[model samples]
Target: MSDTSPPKPVLFRSYYRDWIEVYKKNAVRNVTLRKYLLTLSWVERLAPDLRLSELTRLDYQKLLNDFASEHERQTTMDFHHNIKGAILDAVEEGLLEKDPTRKAIIKGREPKSRKTKYLNHFELHKLLESLELSSTPSWDWLILLIAKTGMRFSEAIALTPKDFDFSKQTLSINKTLDYKTRTGFLPTKNKASIRKIQLDWQVLMQFSELTKPIEEDELIFGSLGKIFNSTANHNLERRCKKAGISVISMHGLRHTHASILLFAGVSIASVARRLGHASMTTTQKTYLHVIQELESKDIDLVMRAMSSLN
Candidate 1:
């Protein structure tokens, strides 16, 4: 037998980060990669100073036991499970001794459901206008792009000049950047996420202008050697505060765009294609409120016509 053992220091960083890298390398979308990294950051905060090998089931359980609400606890519990799941994968790959978080009981937590808060059309336009008035013009364009494209913030930030097809007016959103993996080659949350979007005229125009002085392999939104979204977001938040609007996430623009498209009589497939959704189901679920409104309006018109006929 060889005298060498596996690197004990390998598991020192967050296991969640390692899994994120795995996802990135697998070609995951940038947005999904970022969310996973945020989840990992939360885990790191709860177990600050603890190494990967230092994790215990009890320690993991302890992190979730202190939530004020069952809902909060459960939400955190799922996040806990994800981290533990990552560690388990490491163990399977001979990266660690065993799954230290496996036997840990998340007993105090209660089940809870979660949903994303999306923005409305008026709110979106207001924010877009406000962003334009800021010192950073890049954010104004970047925010509008996501709102129109329904790209996750990271996906938008990780976008490169090569990802755009100005001639076809199409965008290929395959690679993503994450805190764990700063590259575009990563696995997105779902199989369908690795899809393409045909850009609208406005998006194409903005992209063309942005890439005017840049190269194809270079990131379209590159800054001083990094993606520019975070700094843009910070500036955006400051601008929103000055405008007396709530500083919402960049992703909220995605919801606003979806709703507006549905209201404007765009087909679900068309919207899904632009948003790079894997299926119509995702597009429908996301815009269910707008769909219901359309249904209600249709019913009213139908009833009015029947009465007129009588």
Candidate 2:
């Protein structure tokens, strides 16, 4: 005799709570987990009692639209992606008949305009000249290193004397500071971020002297304790004003470094590696405006060359 069993009814909220606890909590980093939790909070607020099998395409679209009403386009896209992942898993588990989030339209409010974040080469030189480097580790020293190396704030702050190779003229970036955990060391952002950036002789010499007295394992800039990015940015802005250049944040120095290299005709792949980017695509997207300007100059050169050939 055949026996029939009733199918279990899984609520979206219940399934999602289990999903995070079982899969996401251990699989993702703290930063990523925090974002997932925020998205989960939205789900709990909007559709707590909705059953997985009962959710329709329109329901999913409405969820995204409701969240997007307050967020920017990029942020809304992230929210949709986070929710869609859980829904797709439910589909795989036979909790739902089909994907409800297919072709969902993303909507969001307009983002605010911001001032330019990078300075031209001439302006960068002026800003660099204004920095007063000393044997003691200060923000000026940090600013100089960032302007020259294009390192992320955490990566720069995590540097120890041994990370620098004076003979090879290289600066190693194998780890980063975990400010969230207040841990002194953490893994780099990605595998690509674990790299040795080549340094100019002047910079190498300066740092070699600066680090000579410090222990190899001791952090160069650890005296500042926990770094506050906003406070550092404010200090950088003051330095720019004193130097009579356009004000930019601490991270903007990385942009300035990359922009100068790209303007000097460095390959995108090289710039991407120098910045420890995961791929050339990221470098291309970040510097699209600069790349476009370079393309225009290339067109002028092409015309001149063809005319001269005739």
Candidate 3:
């Protein structure tokens, strides 16, 4: 017997949108909304073909497995991990009877290196050397801001003139750029991200001299009061490649700042506050391996010296 079935119809489930709206409305930081939005992108792509009534935990598991096969472990873990949070939210909102992502756990996602992958002092020098001759002031100054203050690219991009408090020696972070949204500044990732970071004299001096009649509503690095130049990230990457350095992502610069500070003996709590981590716990997790590695080296050195005495 021949069976004929029509292609399944695609539908945009309101339940997905509902959860997004709920998250956006009540989330502690716009960053939560942004993350949920990213996960929902995958759900949106897959959800259309899915019959809401028939969808089960097994379906999402298969989706995650498919993602794992297509990407490396870390990326796949991020994909499922992020979406699982959304599903958990659904459970909270009474949209689901049972959580589909109940046990979508990650095992080997911990930081693996003590080196804290960032451009070293030499690479930093090279990067600055490359930026010095830019046709625009924003280009060079933006790089300086990151190197000096260690602001995340998104956080830096979202900075408005108001965020810079010269009299107080503080920079307040409220928002950052989210690529998937293709929009203006959205709330940062967590409550702790909305922090006030104090600046060193060098950073303050450079900023004071850099902005000429800074407008309150204007973004710091933007030209003509725009949020960003749009091509900034790609252009910077291309510039790095031309400068004969391996093209590390702009985000790497942020990590580079933290690694340098940690190597210089800055306390983890200070680093967390400066970097706007939601919790010291998050900061610790990120650098725990680095601390362990440093501890091991110190122990080895001590053992060597003791043996010499013996």
Candidate 4:
């Protein structure tokens, strides 16, 4: 009689493919899906022959150590996080008798020096003053929009003439352009990202006239053919260098916007809303340094008031 027993398990890389296809492929954005696919490529490289049934804590630690040898700590942590989900699911499905990733120690190369992520208010003023705004929209307008509104690159690019409510002086951010793949409009980062940001009158007036002759549904900035994030960052860098200020990336403008708001005593909750962060915890973590400085000022104010009463 022919054998009818179940077949032995496949390699861990094969198992990961099945898991990602089932759990991730259609469930995430294209950008996120690419990250998961990149992780799979790494899995194939590091553990091509690792069997799901033969995985152990020691085996997993070795795998992580190998990946950590070249990557920084934070990147290794992300790699571990990406693969951990698949391993946990395998354990739940009885592919492994126990979790192999348990108690795995993460390791990586030393981090490089961090670049300045944001500018102080004075530096930002000089940068803004350096922009050559014209009657028509330009990348400078895009830069100004991000610096003023804290909108993501994708969000700002997706703006339409209709998205601006001239009467209310508000700009609606409900979607994002897939600039990476040029896949047209995609949903906002999350539910909280679908919001309207109130604009200052000067910005409101400039955009109102700029969009007046354009079709309601037309993109405000026009066609940005083959434009990448680096394109904008380079533009900003040149402008910064010209203005004799610290060079920062396009996203740095978003950071500058938030930092200025936090330093000016805007509530964390309000800043979170304006930045379209899913939660205040994210805002708190990102701007913790600014918050700490504000706390020091608050304590000094309290002491001065108390001394006055005495």
Candidate 5:
């Protein structure tokens, strides 16, 4: 019998929804899934009726230009890549004659200049001294740990009493909290992020006393319950004000930790490992200014040593 059914028209939004359901949802983490959904929302807004066969390069460029108008260049790139992945998949499925996103120019406003998000050694010491850690677990404890360990907020929040090895003075980071999903014990950001951080004697003693009364499996900071990043930053800002130090976000403590270590002549590789960065490249890119400053000091030291030898 001859086929007589009409072919279903594939709208851009519909195909993207299907692609996300079948390929992206299970493959990505909840945080990543949320990002994909956000990008899909943009696609829906700009090209609701755009058919797969009718989507020209001009239409796709218009979408990118529209999104880039409000976002930073890096963000716009991420948005472009997300949509392009699905569009390429559609092409492979013979839904389109050619890719519409090819050679699309990225456009965006210039990023605003911002001050460094780390504290100096003296400022950090002042901030630490301000915290009252007398056998009680609070956000102060969390801040202290992050400042010393350079752990990500998610990794630090997910920690339990059992994660601390007092005898060995090591803290294991094998899991992360999914704040977006309000779930506990998700995998770390990357394989490299799963590491054991060595702890100072003082920190170990403080944590030992703090964790003594808590259950082995209970989170050190207890349940935060849907706390937003801005809220956390605001709290940290208050702490900084109380400490009489310049205000910095919670993540700034991580940066401060790494910066202090690098300034103290720690190897880039060791700093990268301690920070749980996926690669040295990531650490380098994040603290390029610090690295450049350190290079200048190294040049001066080399010249002094050479002159002294003569």
Candidate 6:
């Protein structure tokens, strides 16, 4: 007589790998793909024996609690989002009875103190004055470009003489350098990132003279060789200390540019385009504090204008 036995249930980790291979592997950028792979590693580590068919809301909560114990709240939220996508698909495929992630509570460790993210007008002026921009391209030049144009480091480093239009005083942002992998050129961060940013006369003239000797297509800052974001941050930190301003990261230069524009009463839409943000929502969300402060000033102006009408 032949005996029949039940098939072993599929491991949740295995299902997640299949989900990533089918849904995420080729559908996202290499940097984004690596994030999914990282989520997979965490799944394997945290739920090694969890079966797809046995996933429950309780089980999912426990897994998140475990993850949260090691990370900050924002990081925990990102991790939850990454895994939730796969879990939802698994449910639709009839591999699970229901979504285990619904109503799941996200918790995490306390966030550490953050560094100052931007400089004010006077602080920025001092920082710029501290930079020593010489005839040759240097990190200081890169710092100044970001401070002026709000360009991402990758976008600024990928720039060449051909990207600049001196007559129009605009710079084309079409690609970004793959500084992390040393893989040459890559597409911009998003479709919106491919844009033309107008340059002020001073910056246009400075760059025109600077790029005169370099090849039209050669990387503006690539001569530095295998530059990392940290390299730029160190240079910026030195300048900040020398100028006696608050220390900020390389990314802070971006924040500084955006903040200055917003404070100067430039329209949010215009600043959003200059920053190459995918949406004005991103810009508004990132600078909500600045917006609120500006709104208060607007209210004061409104009151004064109304009183004058009497």
What tens-digit string does per-residue lDDT give for candidate 1 at 98-133?
666665655444444433355566666677666552
Superposed by TM-score, candidate 3 places the C-alpha of residue 51 at a distance from the truth, in angstroms, of: 5.7
Clashing pairs in 2: none
In model 4, where is the ten-residue run with the lowest total lDDT?
218-227
Q: Is candidate 1 or candidate 6 better by TM-score?
A: 6
Candidate 4 stretches with Cα past 4 Å from truth are: 1-6
Quick one: best TM-score, which candidate?
6
Task: Put down candidate 2 lDDT per residue, 1-310, tens digits, no spaces.
Answer: 7768787777887888888888899787777889989888988998887887899998888888888888898899999888788889988988788899999999999987866779999999999899999888889989999999999998998999999988899999999987667856888888999999999999899998988888999989877766788878988999999999888988889999999999999999999999999999999999999999999999999999999998
TM-score of each: 0.61, 0.93, 0.71, 0.95, 0.91, 0.96
What's the candidate order when arranged by decreasing lDDT? 6, 4, 2, 5, 3, 1
lDDT, candidate 2, at 270: 95
* lDDT at position 217, candidate 5: 92
| Candidate 3 lDDT over residue span 180-226, tens digit each | 45666677766778888888886786677666566778766666243
Off by over 4 Å in 2: 1-9
Point out the worst 10-residue segment of candidate 3 by lDDT. Answer: 107-116
The number of the candidate with the highest lDDT is 6
lDDT, candidate 6, 1-310, per-residue tens: 8768888789999988998999998788788889889988998999899988999999999999999999998888999999999999888888888999999999999989999999999999999999898998999999999999999988999999999999999999999988898878999999999999999999899999989999998988868877999989999999999999999988999999999999999999999999999999999999998999999999999999999999
Candidate 3, pairs of clashing residues: none
Q: Write the per-residue lDDT of candidate 4 for residues 30-143, one digit (tens) a residue.
A: 998888899999999999999889999999999999999989998999999999999999899988999888888999999998878999999999999999988777889898
Question: Global lDDT of each model?
Answer: 0.67, 0.89, 0.69, 0.92, 0.89, 0.93
Better of 4 and 6 by TM-score: 6
Residue 163 shift from truth in candidate 4, angstroms = 0.4
Q: List the residue pairs that clash in candidate 6.
A: none
Each prediction's RMSD over C-alphas, in Å, is: 7.6, 2.7, 6.5, 1.6, 2.3, 1.6
What is candidate 5's lDDT per residue for 168-196, written digit by digit as tens? Answer: 99999999987766766799999999999
Total clashes for model 2: 0
